[model samples]
Target: MKAIVKLVILLFCVTAFSQGQQHVEYKKVSNNLIKATYYFADNSNAIQSEGFFNDKNQLQGMWVSYDTEGNKTIIAYYDKGKKVGVWTYFKDDKINFVTYKDNKLIGVEEKALVVN
Candidate 1:
């Protein structure tokens, strides 16, 4: 029937729009710098990370990662986007760390930094 076809088309449009909202946006900071601007499925502002860069377009320093739930998952320090220094992992109120340099793991430590 015409009513059923209209409903099906409406549902398809809604689904396509919902999936399209998951895409991430990256804005360039300079000729070599870029930052990822995150958004929720509903297109709400989530978080943003400042991406570092080198003269040759190589990346360096802290790169952050966040959970879909809008929580920070890691604070990863990098040399040319390679893991370096304290790399942190978070779950609930607990935080774990792994030290690295030039993409090589040097040490790891796990502890809960917060209690609530």
Candidate 2:
């Protein structure tokens, strides 16, 4: 029963997220770089996420993601497509912070939401 409940909640979250899926937009920044942004189809046209890519089309710099209501949900840092530094994930009631290096998680901090 516990597993079934968890599955249901997971499915609900996935469905809700897919309903507001963002269409990615890519703009050439140079000979070998691109700036990417995502937009939802709800007519608001707000940026749902944005990031930068390097010459090899690998993610670099800071990548930020926003919820359907334009609330920031995540901020991740990458170096040449490898996850690095501390990544923060937000929700209404909880926050998860994880540190990574070379795409491997090195540390984590889970805390209650502090910012309203």
Candidate 3:
């Protein structure tokens, strides 16, 4: 009985600790812009990313992917953040684009358009 009680206590503590972690929040800056804040899941310092959202808060443009050091690796755009024009991929020679409507991709072309 004592062992079972101890195990229950341990499990409760673990669950509480886990729940205290995983922090994420988003704030609307305007009708079309939102700032998403992320935490380390351990309640550490938060990092922020800006996203463009439609009237329905659907993502339109976002900084997707990150470098090894956490720098933004891709700047993807959307009519709302739906991936409309060229998504500039940082690192190496890669370029991609996606066309979308209502947050659905209608067309995608990758590594095709290059700028000199």
What are the root-mean-square deviations of the candidates from the true structure over C-alphas? 4.3, 9.3, 4.9
lDDT of each: 0.73, 0.89, 0.63
- lDDT per residue for candidate 2 within 1-116, as digits (tens), equals 99999999999999998777657788987886799998865644787899999999899989999987889999999999999999999978999999999999999999996664
What TM-score do all the candidates reach, one by one? Answer: 0.63, 0.71, 0.52
lDDT of 3 by residue, 7-79 (tens): 9999999999987775667778877577666655543554434455666666666556544356666777666
Residue 43 deviation, candidate 2, in Å?
4.4
Q: Which TM-score value belongs to model 2?
A: 0.71
Per residue, candidate 1 scores C-alpha lDDT tens digits across 1-116 of 99999999999999998777755676776676666555556546665344566546566667777765667888887677677889888877678999997888899999977765
The CA root-mean-square deviation of candidate 3, after full C-alpha superposition on the true structure, stands at 4.9
Native-vs-model 3 lDDT? 0.63
Which residue pairs show backbone clashes in model 3?
Answer: 60-80, 60-81, 61-81, 78-82
**Which residue pairs show backbone clashes in model 1?**
none
Clashes of 1: 0
lDDT of 3 at 20: 77
* Candidate 1 lDDT score at position 93: 64
